[model samples]
Target chain A: MRFVLVAGTTETAHIEGISAAGADPALMAHTPSADLEIVEYGQPVQAPVMPVSPTGCPTPAVITRAVHELTEFEILALDAGLVRPTSAPTVALEAMPGRDIRHPRPVDSAADTFEAARQLGRSLPDDELVIGETIPGGTTTALGVLTALGERAVVSSSLPENPLALKREVVDEALAASNLSAGETADEPVKTVRHVGDPVLAAVAGMTIGATTTDTSVTLAGGTQLVAAAALARHAGVDTALSVATTSFIADDETVRMNELANDLSLDVTVTDPGFHHRNHSAMNPYIAGEAKEGVGMGGALALADRAGISMADVREQVVAVYDRLVVDESL
Target chain B: MRFVLVAGTTETAHIEGISAAGADPALMAHTPSADLEIVEYGQPVQAPVMPVSPTGCPTPAVITRAVHELTEFEILALDAGLVRPTSAPTVALEAMPGRDIRHPRPVDSAADTFEAARQLGRSLPDDELVIGETIPGGTTTALGVLTALGERAVVSSSLPENPLALKREVVDEALAASNLSAGETADEPVKTVRHVGDPVLAAVAGMTIGATTTDTSVTLAGGTQLVAAAALARHAGVDTALSVATTSFIADDETVRMNELANDLSLDVTVTDPGFHHRNHSAMNPYIAGEAKEGVGMGGALALADRAGISMADVREQVVAVYDRLVVDESL
Candidate 1:
């Protein structure tokens, strides 16, 4: 089946790095065997500014408009974006100027982007409705949202090496920031999004729930988005068959709190790391590791499996081989 | 970790099904939150066996030993049994007989299994070793081998649902047959295994491979064996740090084609099912789908994203949810 990739500015530079390393070319070459149709979501762009400046936060209106223009393409692949953390904390925001506290780009909240994604989902044909996202500072926001929603979420800055430590720090910070007790909602899931969540997360969550038609499959590309989408699916009460894919590392205890939230929601999840064999050990930064812990593109793979009526093993082999080659190229 | 499951079984009166089911109470009342080490692999047993004549196939000595010693405590937590198929085409024999070949158990041809799994890795740990099987028409020989290998693989026989049409007819024909391929080496995996594959599928494939030490942070669990595993790791001559889990719907194709095949040749391979959701659907049959496809698990999951760590939205969500559930149970 044809597959579309929604590109976001979240880590646009990272995507560029991957492309420059020939990941895209290698992947494109293998398409014949996998029978996948891939298209990027948003046009390539510079990283969005973070912590709105004196110029003011890029208007959400601009983001909305840009997305609208991009949607003009007959087939919208996937929605993704970049994330930048504000220098100050949310509680300290009152003392800072709006420009100082605001993040660059108008879509401040995951909710906004999620809303756009929802609209995109609605716009697609039933069978063509598949969505995904990318946000650089997303893990941090994911922590924010998960904490805000009263669930303990681990947030980490991207490190080229030692991502586990970063993940631990984020999880610790989120746990400390939240007021809710852990495992209190043992019988059911606690409302994870309402507490310390972001706008983009909310938007993706909305899009996933909104696009729950039988024929459509919604994929949340990043670890943070996957957590958000699970919370959304749980809260939205959408029961259409769904799948989530993430890195093998993110399946660890620190990051797995999000998974617990998903179980409460009765969602089927799949964890994967495509380029396991080609991991860049020399460039191993905690931030990168933390991001690697989250991984990406697993959601779409599941959708493909479902659509193709193939087994999970078949898909894993195809993706892993391509991913390994791509990552190896990057290391070089 | 706490895990919840819905138990289903088609065999109980016979030893074959029971051996393959692994643990029951552990599978059922499995609460991830409880102070217990829980792993759910087997489903519950259903009916008693109906008297039937022997299928007259030579069974492995190892399989026979494992079945005769079955007990309640072991039933709570143990590996499932593997059996050889007595009826059905070689391609369609991946699943157990009378189990509605819709969702067949994944099995790999001997060569593929050994090349992709056995020969690919370092020696396995003794403590973690336990075997399981998935071949149809495997019990009788299990009895024979228990008499020979000193293991219990068969206790009783359950008549096939439609004995006259499928199981019985196939068994009787086999009793009168002779020429069959021997050893792991053969030209065609499906054909080789069809002539000789047995309950060893669950045992040898499951036990030996399961004993290896790999990172479980990411696991590839489902369909076939060798190819699925190799695909996940890509066998690129690198030490793999990722954890892989595999499942089989049929025998390994490689094993049937090669001689002097070593078991540890395919460390990169991890087999698993394609459909992780296991949702009940009338339009699809899991077994058929599995046999038609090859390789799965973590490898398949990786294909959904851009090699740079971009994931498909849907795959991310699904994997995250499943992982979240797994983690939550672990914490419990």
Candidate 2:
């Protein structure tokens, strides 16, 4: 079955001293590269450039854009909240402006935005929905949400060496900011999001509930963020089958306890082997170096392409081509 | 016959020295009363209250809200662009943040935003679509686009008296900025919107095309702003059955030759009167005074209710009740 990827963001990425999204934290807002990449594919981009991870790799949205071009999978860019506006034609979840999570109440209208996303989910065609997120510093929020739910969680990141220290510290600050003990926040997902989580978490979680409530198979297509959404869905008693599809890179991140986190969260995990190691492009190197491990539905796009009988080689070639267009020629 | 009121904004409303939207044109930016009002019928709002015309009648959103509550038609709130975030859950069209039309090219991404709206239009359930728009200062932009499209358009206003001189001057300025003549922009609706229209115009026009392309029975809701959308749909060769449903205030405004404009534009128009004169609430006075002649899908909502066997008195009573809730209890 074809898949649709929902993209969202969070302001937690732009915290004064956090780089959880990528090496250069400021570029986190330009994350919706899929919008421009798809529109200007095979063309030159001027003015604003495609966002680059600190490691010199393009956005994971390139991966999703390539898959869309190759397999014709319908893709959706959802603005949960972004510091910068997406040029891509997006299904605005109408979460409004990018939110700063530094505030005690990060998302005041969490319930309302979630209802909107849920309605959007229920309205979609029955195609399997592969939801993804690209909020910079989002994993920190994810870690915050998961930890609030009482699981010791570590998530991979755009940085080659995961910043476990900073992530933990931020999670601690988030919990403190909420003025709620982690245990108290665990059973209240909506409250959890309002206190510490960003708009993306609430939107994705709501989208999951909407889609799953309608019995659509949903692949939470990223790492810890999806897990946070799954936790919310599970808490809300959503019975639709849900799974996490990611690259082996995320699965094999030595610093992260993915298996334990998944098991603790009761989320099904599916890992795809893109075999980037065997690929010829230097563009794939940053991915292996672990900058932007998985985002913008990269893992899920790869999985869908694979399911459609598209090869890893084909996926790699498309990624490399998009990378060359974006990085080499500097065209979006 | 369910309806979706897609609300958006343009910085054009916030333009200095222009009061084309309403008496207190500065409040034009907070025009999402359609969103919150339609959602919470008969309620008071905080921070941002429902827009009130100079005559002190509430925004037409009150009319739409009363109808929506009276008839259980499914409603969707769409965000094209807004200076303030909508308190209600909304399907965001993600047309970047509100742009100042004073810049001459307010909606640079008009084509893409339209495509997104069109896609959204195509994805709705098989129910007949009634699309409405709410953009403060939108009437002037409507005048600009309509005039550019070769129609001697005179649109109604939120003020009891029309501001024809200032509107014409601004339209002239917009034409000069876009470097286009009235005849030159006639065949190009997207260009017309990008040049002189707001995000609401592009989004609603795109929605019309999308639904019409898919052969969905579509009703263009609201006033002259929707006329611009109909003009775009017609210019684009959309063969779907298209009609506009508006309030009697819009059709019978003696000051504005709406009938001549409609005939000149080759568009079908349907007018619904909620018989607001019989209503007892002082809040409904602004509408009768020619303030906020149409907005937030109020006209279409009333027409749909009237068709569904609801009486004008019933609609008016609901409206009066909501006015009391908003003015007295403030429950939003």
Candidate 3:
């Protein structure tokens, strides 16, 4: 089998740790055992080209480009700046009441990205198609989207040590600001997108629904992505597994609230926490720990596992190998 | 934090998948979030280096080299192997007595590689001591070593599907060829390394023991490697945590024979299966299934989890991710 990995942050994609983590499992499994082919999404999205934000979130324009470039991949598609609502709600608003909610330059709205993803899905072979996503700052946005759509969610930062309070505070504030409530069932909640969600969530939701109808498995590889995808799945009435590749930090109590929100949505969710098994001893550094807590595309990883029928142990080992390499690189 | 993986073969090291299959709570508690780290160990020792074997096992040296060369951060140390006896045996000589048994090539020998590992470990900072191994056909050698030293082991495989019969057959053959009975204890098994086990096993044992004494958590990234390291820990009388990473395939075994072996030596054993909660959906190929049936280094992954204090759910998720990627690659 051949895999063409869609790169989201092109510049960071080549970073030794990131590439190693993404590629190791495929390489190991296919090298001597099966005929495996791998191709990375060639487009490069440079990091640090735009100043690093104190919030640690990438700019929206960067995200749009990331998703736009995903057109190159035959299977995988990615957008750095898209997020989804955590739950379903019935409401429609023409625009936010006070927030300017300006569309950043080189604007590619969630709908645009969604269409692109749908087009990518349309181009695939009729066999079981596997679709995954990668987005940074996704979990926080996932929390915003979920709350905006009326699903109570607990957001946890990816810090090495638990940062439950901070995550919860952010989630609560976002929901309050949006005047959103959890446990609401609506025919549609289009307004939530403008108030709390980002473009990635909408794109993934559209892609997932489109792919599932064709009997494909859509895996959201990060915790945040899973939450966004799950909400979209729920909203769209799509029946497919929603897997979340997380760490112990995310799977544990501090993050359980987020999982509970997922459960409430009746989303077929699976969490893959590589940290619980393969501890990245080197990642214990406070700095790296902080980055980990930010939550990468782990939800999509879990979704991939669900589609693949793989056991958790295998996933943990692979993620750990990648994580260990990442930590080592950071130390260097 | 960075790991350089080297794959070795130790067929006798495998144990039944019953523990994971049963989801034994005790075992679950110790499971690592991730388990295996795939990389090349020196060269193919058992199967011929062909594109495809009659048994469908592709014994490709290129695969091994690919794993080794793909490494970007950590230096690849290919040569040393490690395995633990199910029982405390007096000599390593009585462990593996098959026609294929011989000293691992000097470049691939345990003693030489271990010396290098010792130097490497000594040079690195506390966090940079991440180590992994790849020993094909290792479980058999592990059982041979353990049994020669008087340990009772029900060696099994970690094939995607169960291969209990094939695993049993291999175990029976290795035992039949040995001079030691199943229950005889060897007071000094390490000294007899020349008689029973191969070179890589001895070196890994040495490296792990050496790493532990240095005040850092040394993870045995493979099952056989962990088992072998655990045995060394017992011999050395240390109480440090050695992390063992494995997949759900290993955890599926209900017998807990591998755990029993680790416990017998009074070595702290932690088992992690990354497969339990993975999202991958694919059938296990027979050849790879056969290898899994012969058991992979699940014990090692478990040990790593125990030492790391990781949870089962987390480990399962990570393993699932890796397994999904592997399966996806296969289909491609």
Instruction: Give the C-alpha interface root-mean-square deviation per candidate.
Output: 24.1, 11.5, 25.0
Per-residue CA lDDT of candidate 3, range B45-149, in tens? Answer: 111121222233322222222322322222333323323111000111111212233322212243444454444443333453445444444455555566556
- Cα lDDT of model 2 by residue, A66-147, tens digit: 8876876544556676555433434456575435555788778778778878886765544578888767777777777777
Candidate 3 per-residue lDDT over residues A1-332, each given as its tens digit: 10112222111112122221122322211111010001111111111022112333221122122222232212222332311210010011111111212211111244554555554443333344433333333445556556555666555543334444544455455556545555342334334444455454555565566666676655544455456656766775665665444434455545446567667765554554433323443322322344443222333334344445655555444434434443343356
Candidate 2 residue-wise lDDT, B1-332, digit = tens: 54767677777666544443443766666656434543443442222555665446676777777887777665556778766754354556758644665567878878888888888676543457898877777888888888788777677766677777777788888888878777578888888888888888888888788777667788888877787778777777776567788899988788677677667656678899888788656867667767777887877888888898999999888888767766664343
Q: What shift in Å separates residue B194 of candidate 1 from its native position after superposition?
A: 74
How accurate locally is residue A309 in candidate 3, as Cα lDDT from 0 to 100? 65
Which segments of model 1 are wrong by more than 4 Å? A1-75, A78-114, A128-130, A155-199, A213-215, A219-224, A236-241, A247-249, A252-259, A272-296, A302-332, B1-332
| Error of model 3, residue A153, in angstroms | 66
Predictions in order: lDDT: 0.30, 0.71, 0.39
Model 1: chain B TM-score relative to the native chain B: 0.25
Q: Provide per-model DockQ scores.
A: 0.01, 0.03, 0.01
Candidate 3 wrongly placed segments (more than 4 Å): A1-332, B9-77, B81-99, B102-110, B128-132, B159-189, B236-243, B275-280, B283-332
Error of 1 at B87 (Å): 53
Best lDDT goes to which candidate?
Answer: 2
lDDT of 1 at B297: 18
Q: How close is every model to the real structure, measured as TM-score?
A: 0.31, 0.56, 0.35
- Pairs clashing within candidate 2: A158-A292, B42-B322, B44-B330, B44-B331, B158-B292
